[model samples]
Target: MPTVPASRVPRRRTPAAAVVLSVAVFLGTVLSGCAYEYSADHWDDESTSAAPPPSTDAALPQDPHLNEPVTGEELDDWVDAVLPDAAGQVFQTGFGTLEADEERKETTAQLPKGTYALTLACRSTRRVSFSIENGEDELVDLSLRCGTSRVNVVQLAADASLSIKVDANAPANFAYRVSRI
Candidate 1:
């Protein structure tokens, strides 16, 4: 009897059969776990799956001018209504001061095309940051100290409107002075 070398043995290809069998086994295993009935009556039971009808409460009145841009006079009136003491304060090149309570308060003014300095001094017991915005954009965001002042200079190439908004993290009373230089 002649002994054949190990390298001379023919290797039969079974990868295709193995792959097909593996895929069939995997699909059978997955499908066996999903044995749910497909009947409309199974899901249409009123007692088990009925949602309550929506409440028929009266609709709230919507503001007509809610999306309108605020005019200078309207902004002035809003400031006076919220912070009555700060009303009628002029924001000229001189000095103007305003007090802010726990609620957010705003002051709006029209600025000419020039460079001007702004000074903000707030006496806040709680931590807070004041925001200066032009339209929807924030120009200055200042973190106020208890008894200190911060100053910033802004330049306007075109005539624009600006609004100063005071916000406190906690309930606080803050007195801020705005001076133009």
Candidate 2:
């Protein structure tokens, strides 16, 4: 059988530099996550950006459901894949009796639309990012390279609220959000 060239596939519109950074983030963050080493170094991209802190009295969801946090497993499912080295290192620590809210949805929080902020507590700082794709395969691949990964989540207001919760015994917890400048 004849083989098709790798170039046959359309390239992502994301800049090559951005792809490198995103991959770096995946390699740096996911490896630790899969190793069960909780860390926030993963959000070095999101935590360092210009996203400002939100006011407590700012807009909020009338539904208490929005106030709830997103779980690690939920975030895991959204992750399409990981660095080649991290593929076999996934370590899960299950402690909850309550099931994840499957009906919950994600509304892109990046500005000028709106920024999404979330909190993640872990034993290390190497866990970062969310790659979500709808039917069109338009994926959200934030990385340290594009400078969209490091934002103070609590200060950012999201069009739709989401969260990432590690076990309480985990090391560090981050409260972050993504929104327009």
Quote each prediction's TM-score: 0.41, 0.19
Q: What would the per-residue lDDT of candidate 1 be over residues 41-152, giving only the tens digit for each residue? A: 6557566666767876578664544322233565444334433232223354211223333446566467666765565544335555777777777778888763455667
Give the alpha carbon lDDT tens digit for every residue of 44-91 in model 2: 666766466666764764553322334587434322221111222122
Best by TM-score: 1
TM-score of 2: 0.19
- Candidate 1 has an lDDT of 0.56
- All-Cα superposition RMSD per candidate: 19.0, 25.8
lDDT (0-100) at residue 140 of candidate 2?
43
The number of clashing residue pairs in each candidate reads: 0, 33
